[model samples]
Target: MTLRATIVRPDARIVVQFSCGAASAVAGKLALAQYGATHDVQFLNAFLASEDADNRRFLADCEIWTGRQFTVLRDEKYGADVQNVFLRERYLKGPHGAPCSKLLKRRLLDAWKKPGDVMVLGYTAEEADRLEDFRERNPDRPVIAPLIERGLGKEDCKAIILRAGIVLPYMYRAGYSNANCPGCPKGGEAYWRAVRVDFPEVFEARCQVQDELGPGSWFLRYRSGPRKGERFPLRELPYGPIRRNESLPSCSFFCEMAEADIIHKEPTA
Candidate 1:
């Protein structure tokens, strides 16, 4: 199957988000194939100090695949540090999401985007529900979900990335689902335990951040599931939990909060 019929305004710049994952890489390549020669298209990433170095290598390989260099967009004010986000914002997440996502990613998108740019995301067909939710929640965003449009799945994306001669990010090889921050709060007990084993230093740093956030502030907060409000300290987690077949939420700079300047959306004062 081919991509959906897309029209690129000659003057509109296409802003493709590369999250250092296979799906995003495939989306970026398809965007270039469709619009790069005739339109202004650029790839962007919200870098974090906490992301794996493998992410950088994957990005470099993707750059070669696209034949275009990425324009790295960062929120210098936050220094893109997860711990800094907790200390300054005084919390990890709120009604919206983790503060680090808003400050580092959404804020920069807010600053860099303009009227004629269309934001493109790599939500594969497997994520049709998320794509639908994003469309419903963000009617104002000039965004395109290409993978879903093309009926591609995660495995399809992996094949596409391999066909381009690029290696998948190390985390994917190491058994993590996505190449998000090593200690991303979107993870659960099992995910954190994996982090403790695969990324010991990152695990220690997140432990420090959780302590700094004080009691009751944690990575996992299940409101309705069996693990309701399970905010157990990562320090106490045993290694046996690491092998559970569980999932972690995917992280996107924009999708995390859906909007920048979420001061009014803060759950805490």
Candidate 2:
């Protein structure tokens, strides 16, 4: 079915994109507190098949905590698989962004968005550049980055989620910072190394795909290190410490919001 066909309610003007991460859960709570009484707030998630099973558990807990049903959206086109798109388009992630993300989420969000609806995203204070980039790029999407606005950090979000009685996702327990898909295509040497220890089968599958994609097509591209711009396949990735401790910045519906912002900013025909 098309994305527009999945809209049971076409008029939810206040929408929250729940990434099923700690900060996202907390952001949804804050949005509900601010706007639920005055507007019909809707919570939406663009589903990813590669995500851990415990992400569902976290989603369930957030539903209970927020007292609202979270809508799970899928890209009917790609069926939410990055590999499927990679194989079909003969391309994996590029320097600009992930094709899987654009086809699945960014496009879906565009089709699902209603005119004048407010989009709530979970971006923490540390991601000031991303927040600025988003705002600078999309000046008319009626978007709100609550965590950034409040100067809340990752730990603050975790504390709020725990106080509300929601257990963190299993990925967190396993020392993963962001609850992105297993073996996220954008991961680095440190990230893939951690994935090898945490999920071997996933690591193997990613390696196989990298081999299939040839030497130039790789998941990560290093900028400053010895290997700069060269495709660093997961197969050769050495075991190392995970990136920047166990703390990572909040996950955003990055491309989707950017697309919406740009489209809405255009002069209407």
Candidate 3:
């Protein structure tokens, strides 16, 4: 989607991209508090089929906590299926990014968004750089980061949710930090090993996708050794203990840095 500034609407909408994560849930509450009186604040969640089913339960709980309904959207082309994107796009992780994000989340949001619409993202103060990167990349897109502005981080968001009497998504309770896809391509070997244990079906399904897409769809790369920087197949990934504290940032619009620890390149178009 080619982005350009549009003439401001007299009654512009405040569109909060709610990703069913703690930060976005709190961001929605904050946005409603700050702009519900003056602006038409709406929550939008681009539902991903690969995300933990508990995310849907969390979404409903968050709606009650925020006292607002969410307009959940699905990818028209891929039906919000991460595996479908990987198969059709014939790619997964790359210097650009995983196609699942571009097809399922980004494009869905772009289609629903309009120029002059104020976008409230879930970026926290700790993720200020990601917010800036998003702004630099899409200068025309007006954004309001309530969490960052409030100086809240992931832990703070979690606390706020609990204080509201809302249960965190099962993904968090299951020891996964972010409520992302069960077998998120951004995860490293250790993370995948955890998936192998927790969500064996998802791990096996992703391995099947790799088999279909060939080597290009591999999601892991060796960090140090003779084969460093080479893509590693998930099926061959060795089993290992997962760090209980291994936390990956929740993936959302403008938070592509989830892959920063692994790959660095210009943002995907």
Candidate 4:
């Protein structure tokens, strides 16, 4: 008598997009490393914003980890278009008005996606809602959530990165939260507060966008909170000049929102 083992090979090509965050980027890097080591895989740098030192660091880390050259796709042009008012009003409205994600992330992904290729998203099981949302939106794309499949939450992913000896992005350390952008519209009041305190220049730029686009424009409606409330008073908060320090606030975006001022006072006419 004889026994035999069968190896099942994946049908679709695997590609992980690096977004430059503690959890997502690390997860993507790990996936790239693992798949590249055992099977054929491709890595992509779908950078939607300007190249910064932090972005370079993530790329370098990916190179070191995967021992392979990663392909870079420039999507900064798409990100810039979202800054335009006409485009925002004409195409995106209400919940979709902020086109940052669509322009910066989604468009790039669409351009790179192949019919049979599997897109590996960094969403974890803890973010079930987001995972479901991604699946719903990209029904034809066949998205794969390896982090969720592995039962690794954000903290676990962070621990993996730390254990791997790769430092997280400076924005994460500065307490601005998500590494998407320094002043992402998805950020909450405390996120803005942290921005105002830690990255004054970026905060000022965001305020300028608000001033130009009018209030309640740049940030996500829920995350922005009420129009009348000030999570951190603009007058009292730090602004203009930038400063840097090694230590970061203990809490990141997830925990910081709770401490923010959430109430909105009625506007006086």
Candidate 5:
């Protein structure tokens, strides 16, 4: 008996979610290159018309490599504005993980997705929970995780980009784990600590936002109770020089907040 083979023709439109991070952007670029080479797929950037030069550069590189003119869906107004609203309402409380992901990244994708187009996410197998969550949330559309399928983790992604003679995003070299934004409210103490050292201005701005939101609005809570009768340290901690080879710290505190049921009931919609 002979087995029958079924081949699904590639869709004309493909959206690559670009977060300006090393791993995700690289994965998106690779996907675009592959699809452009093999099919009649048009690459779409989540934030194509934004003023961000870095985002523009990434798109330009994709076009250069693929030799195809990709269409960009402009949604500049909604991206940052909605993200700010989400952060102020939902994430300003305790360690709710980066609201920017929900507001800017995922929201952009949801808006741009069409009925038959394949949505490619830049998640690797290393982010198992995230991958599962993406699939669960967007069950209607077929979401492809090419990097995850290839067993390419963060390190492997970096190698791929470097081998292509492309420079990784500055945020990666600046010690950010994933580039959502500068001083994201979802950042943990260690992440903040690193930011305080690497990007002091951004860290200070985040503290200012926390201050304006008042008590209980702060993202960072002492893991352990404060020293008995001891006062909270109002001043910023002196962060040491970051090591180049040092692995970026995970947003562990934000993850805990989700588990601990500490999210504020602010409607994202």
Candidate 6:
């Protein structure tokens, strides 16, 4: 009698980091459309307390649109609170980066991400430089940036999400460019001013964080004059019209993998 051998092969896992922004939402959709049959694609989110409360609503909408639920990861130590990360680390922003990015996102990713899992992000055609920077830093990790490959930009991503009948998050509607945590430390003068006006509670919370971190801790910068490159405090930022041109760098954990979401026809505020 002859015996035949049987082999089993598991589908490769494609982990999409969905940050609840339009770009990421579209990217996740694209990844699913392309790989859902051949690969085990999973959407992941590094939830932060600082993001707008409406992010949860947008997240649910995206899940319905995509027909796939996200595996949410968060900094258990800080309960995914950016402020707690800052306070515990005894630091805010610096030349390297912010502690919240490190502790809230990256560390959680390191713990949860598995070997042999291909990662996906929302880097668009305009962000090829960022994609390249991430690859240069994380040569060992396999990644697939669908937005970049498809020549899509942020607007394209937003359009795609809108077509899918999902409402964009409140942050984007409010005129802040990206869906990063409200009062993200990476914001500039205009960004902070927008935060102050649109999200006064969040702005004041960030100011309180700076006060807690104490001297030498700052989240803004002086664009010109002798103070150029000096750390500017959030409280000192003057109220003014927000310049819509500025966009925040993506703030997911893997951003340092380099580094650096959405919905809807939701009407712009």
For 1-269, candidate 4 gives per-residue lDDT tens digits of: 11111122476677766666655565566667556666556666655443245857866785786576777766555554334422344322233223455555555656776767755566665765655644544444455566776778877877787787887766656544446555454444445566576566766765665565554443333323364343332333433333332122221221111122111122436
Per-candidate local distance difference test:
0.76, 0.72, 0.79, 0.53, 0.52, 0.77
Mind giving the per-residue lDDT tens digits that candidate 2 earns over 225-246? 7877776667777555666233
lDDT for each residue of candidate 3 in 1-269, tens digit (9 for 90 to 100): 22223343548898888888899988889989988888889999888888888899999998887888899888777878988888888877776567677678776777787767888889887888877667666666677788887789989999998998889988889888878888887777889889888889988999998998898778787777798888788998865668533666567765542343224444456
Q: Which 10 successive residues of model 2 have the least lDDT summed?
A: 1-10
Sort every candidate by lDDT, greatest first: 3, 6, 1, 2, 4, 5
lDDT per residue (tens digit) for residues 1-269 in model 5: 12112232564455555444455556666666567666555455445222234556655665665566655544454545423554456444334355544444445555666667765667665765665654444454455666776678888877777787766656666555554454555445566666676666756665665566554454444445444333222134434444433343222212332332333334456
Off by over 4 Å in 3: 1-10, 244-249, 256-269
Candidate 1 per-residue lDDT, tens place, 13-107, comes to: 99998888888888888888878788788899988877888899998888888889998876678788887887777776675667787788877
Evaluation by lDDT, superior candidate among 2 and 6: 6
Better of 4 and 6 by lDDT: 6
lDDT of 2 at 35: 76
Per-structure clash totals for the candidates:
0, 0, 0, 0, 0, 15
Considering every candidate listed, which one attains the maximal lDDT?
Answer: 3
Q: Identify the superior model by lDDT, candidate 2 or candidate 3.
A: 3
Per-residue error (Å), model 3, residue 200: 0.8
Which has the higher lDDT value, candidate number 1 or candidate number 5? Answer: 1
lDDT of 6 by residue, 71-147 (tens): 98866789888888777787778666777887788777888888888888788889888777566556666777888
TM-score of 1: 0.86
lDDT of residue 45 for candidate 5: 47
In candidate 2, position 160 carries an lDDT of 90
Assess candidate 5 and give its lDDT. 0.52
For model 2, the stretches where C-alpha displacement exceeds 4 angstroms are 1-12, 221-229, 244-251, 259-269
Better of 2 and 4 by lDDT: 2
Off-target runs (Cα >4 Å) in candidate 6 are: 1-10, 226-229, 239-241, 259-269
